[model samples]
Target: MTRIRLAPDDGKAINLNWRDRFVATDILRDAYVRYEESLNPSAPPFVTLDDGLELGIVHSDVPAIARAISSMLTCSLEDAKNENGGHLPSAVVERVQLEIISPWGVANLWGQTGHRFVLSRSGGGGRSEILATILVGQSRQTIFFLTGRYNNLRHSTVEEEVDFDQPAGDDPDQRWFDLFAFPEIERFKPWGYHHIANFVVAKGHRGERLSRRLLEGIIERYAKDHLDANERPIEHGQHLLCGRGFWQIGDPPWLTRMERLGFYLRWGAESFFIEKPWAPLPAVFDGDRKIGNLEYNRSFGLPERYQGPRPTVASDEHLLERLPEVIALSEDPNAKLQYFQTMFDFC
Candidate 1:
């Protein structure tokens, strides 16, 4: 029998030893329900999909829903340890745990600026079993807030003094100008940049390619110019100038998957753990053996060629040629930071 252990907080750990007969999905569903109930008793309803799964967007505007979503994200990361042979670092775990538990941190991370794409299924007794989730920030304000939040998080952790409070006078608009502070940034303002802040799939669903589906949904919805919920034209105007995100080291497979989905290393903005104080480098392990560092804090952008209504998927031949260069830059972070720092400049 293949026995699977769960996190202690998951509520299933007690019976999991004897429940080896249960399928992976069934086990995951029960654990998700228990976690959700503990986090939020009055969780909101979600849209049911044809396959019995539920798909919904948890808006930061709804505090109760946001808190529940935050809790789930933290739990999902915790669950990852089981899949990774229990090699997930404590620092990475603690950072996320702190982020969700921190005041206004959830809001700053997934609040007003963006919403999360959640896939779940009815877990019986009026609870939904979360399967996969991706957090997206749609506005420039989100970019500013995220950049500042990450910078602050890195600084605080590295200094050995962690503070989760939202910094005073940390206005997104002001922070945007403060970070960029360059004439060149103005030229690329027309391209509406969105951010993929964080994403994760449940342990049972790892090989299912749910991540790609989530990305495809975002592309179909926001890739073109569209009206907002208010029915007014979006201020940034059409063409998702670029979808931006950070790539940590050690996940080369993730890099290849993203490249196939139209994402690429934004040429000049390479960040190294040794030199860049802003990039958080958490130690990662493989079972008892210590592998390399986990995350590199490097930035990647969706290319302009894939910005239109229907993006032409990058061919395998192209990925074969480009993957090496992308891998090389990620491996060697000390590579110089270029003048055009933003994704708009590169994409």
Candidate 2:
């Protein structure tokens, strides 16, 4: 029961209202971050995958990441104001940013890839800052790609001079992480990921084996979460970590480059949740098919019935998609935990 403490308190808990991106003022966002931090911040679950791979969750930086993602991947403020009906013109851009970085939207994208949240990397890590849910087994091919890896493992002291960490104020750098740079982190990075939408190394820390260390961190996270009471590693069948552009099937150059990191599957399927990180809304998947939010329920571990059914994320719907999922977790922690740890560990 030894938890991974982020600060004094932090956990792998995901934000239930992750879809609500309309964080208006600094006051509101500050309050929300405080509230989330208060949720027993502890060490996130982590696990070791192999010699140079580790996995762990980002616990306290959820809100920080949310804000940063909005800013980093958003449109101009004036354009956002026009998107919404001139309401809150000053805050219109912020509103649009919120919708753009909806937590559920990001999660959906994670699921679309083989690294779906519910399906992969279960059993631990601060589920809050999940990158991907990787199943463990002996025969599984854990395919991690090296498309984004640096060219060499040479030594360099250049990155040490610049500090990527941010002060306690509203500094944008504070919201970013230095996974490869290894800077003096007075503050942590923007956030963690599950399906790893953006696991980038700051330009300054591009090479010198920093990316390798980052990979080890990811593997360590998985090992921590998937271990048994006996401290034995769980081996899921065919586990594979992938690099970017991996989706570009049949690329000989991509294949040759990725082979250095790990396995290279020529025919593994890849998915793209187009709605994610764009159209913000919770999804209702009935078995393999996606139903409206209304059809989801506790029986299937989703909740469209509790509230009314909603349409698309872009529609005029104020649906709270995290509520049902949160309730289910509370209702059956043991079962869910057990299920996550083993049910699909081999799939």
Candidate 3:
């Protein structure tokens, strides 16, 4: 067994763990929901698919004796009767306990680390709270899963090699990772970048800079795992912090801090952008030379490729005008199913 040591046991150590499972029940499920809402009040009011994730307990292994007995019961009615005739024989079973809770199940963090990250606090009773989290992974599979559409899975890839250990030739969708690619960027090759988002800051802890600390923890963890211990001054490749620009603040202006630390803008799409090598951009591109970038902080803008009608009402007048038809469709089960995924029309 290899026992590795971590350097700098300070307040900055990342709390990475391998499949840490806490005893789960109905109570914990509700508590988790409360935990999420307390951080982001904008989350859905009730349990929808977006909020309907839960830990599933599965018996990963059954002892050979148990399997033998089960086979006997299946094959011989007489043997089954011997075990059940007003006296069902029960025996202690040995098995491996595996919990099926991933980020999606435990906290609605759709694409979370397969390995859990647990913190060791000062007091014995640690706080069971998740103030903020960032889900980092690779490629189009991340976006494909988030869109909740299965048919379009094949069309989502931007790069070929994902950062997963899945065997070659397996279904990429089932692998839970994506690769990085930017067609607009200069002859961009398949890059080993991870997507970092689903970041949330608890309502009360809003200004505490927990987000920044969490990001640092992530970098620490990443570096530690990729350490070339045999080689001095371990080197790593530059990557992307994939973020959407549709939010009110858009692409966390705090990212500018990372730019100062050697990160810079690598690509800018209509509603998304990426940073590479730690650099800054006073203004992001508008996908044109003559039109050029409109200057920094265009958080209010939508995708340039979006051809959807503009809002008629100040708040959403254009969309509101189409509500009656959407409502009518909602009245019929078939129509509702057909149009349910069309969020723009309903909104």
Candidate 4:
């Protein structure tokens, strides 16, 4: 099988880590599995270029993590820091799969979306750099603008709901939640509305035009040409879809410049995971009576036990509250690829 190749000066060689790689791999694998499950007919197992290359997340406790973050977001950072004992939130520490890469043998996987990106090393003794980043893709929805309800196609069960006020799910079946927005459009604006995800770029490589191309490539490849859960495009006969582009708060870093590239500021709730919460669960029916807290799992494939549970994003109000903190932390930036590979067990 053809694999992605890295340059001698490729960032992976300069700053690869095992722990982060494991996290990235886990996410990649999960994404592939979920993607395959969405097929009309179950597709074959999803793998990257080669069979030996594996992907996944490392932490065992994912649901609990969302809960921790949710709690932190609702309260002050003092509360957040105090509860977590001054360490990075367990969710961010154990589960967050920032990104990672390996020798693909033939091709290269690069990006900023914590999925793919470019890496470079300054000649001489200068620092290595991640030239550009782009969070590749997301599933879109055509939902009621006010209600935030999705137009369900493939996963009709998830499509029917319009709940935005409550946490996503505490039970098995309803593992994740979705958000919606109606982006504003004006004469000065390049495009009125588009859904956005967060992104970060390596220093020095930030402003180059080619970097813009890389970001555009990732978005176009993943966002366009894909249909909603209902298998319909967001707009008729057009690939235009909805999403949010993130900007770091304070000091207006690289992401701020993206505004000229067709992105806008939008608001939403921060996503959260409630571990073993007493919170009521989604309703299920057993002929006549309503049942609560069902164990949700799919049969006929890899061990369900191997899969990590999904987490729900925060509501607009919650997200709006903690938005500044999110950007504040994003600005400080975390260790580069080399920092991770040297410290963790990714492979």
**Candidate of highest lDDT:** 1
How do the predictions measure up, each by TM-score? 0.47, 0.26, 0.30, 0.27
In candidate 4, stretches whose alpha carbon ends up further than 4 angstroms from where it belongs are 4-91, 98-130, 138-157, 160-198, 203-213, 216-262, 267-347
User: What TM-score, to 2 decimals, does candidate 3 have?
Assistant: 0.30
User: Candidate 4, overall lDDT?
Assistant: 0.26
Better of 2 and 4 by lDDT: 2
Ranking by TM-score: 1, 3, 4, 2
Task: Residues 1-347, candidate 4: write the lDDT tens digits.
Answer: 12232344332221222112122222223322222223232432221112122211111112221112122212222212213442223333222221212222101221211222222222223222223333222222211112212221122223234443455456444433322111111111112122222233333334655445544443332333333433542221112223433222211122235445543332321112122234332332333444222121111111221233321322231224434433332222120000000000001
- Pitting candidate 1 against candidate 4, the one with the higher lDDT is 1
Top-TM-score structure, candidate number: 1
lDDT of 3 by residue, 1-347 (tens): 12122122211111122212222222222222112313234542222111222111111111211121122212222221213331111120000001111211222122233112211111113322333333344332333222111211222353332334352235544332122111221212113233333334433445665555554444432333332322322121222123221111113333444344333333222122222223221222233321112222223221221235433323211233333433333232222110011001101
Residue by residue across 1-347, what tens digits does model 1's lDDT show?
12232122332111112112122333332222111322223443333444675454544333333344455555555644523554345655555556542223444444544455667666565555566766555443233222234422221132243232333355533322232221122221223345455566655667777766665544443333332332432222122313333222113224555555556533323222232343333444455544443232232232222233332333221222333433454455433212222221111
Which 10 consecutive positions of candidate 2 have the poorest summed lDDT?
338-347
Please give the RMSD to the true structure for each candidate, in Å: 13.0, 22.7, 22.7, 19.9
C-alpha lDDT score of every prediction, in listed order? 0.39, 0.27, 0.25, 0.26
What's the CA error at residue 186 for candidate 2, in Å? 48
* Model 4 weakest lDDT span, ten residues long: 337-346
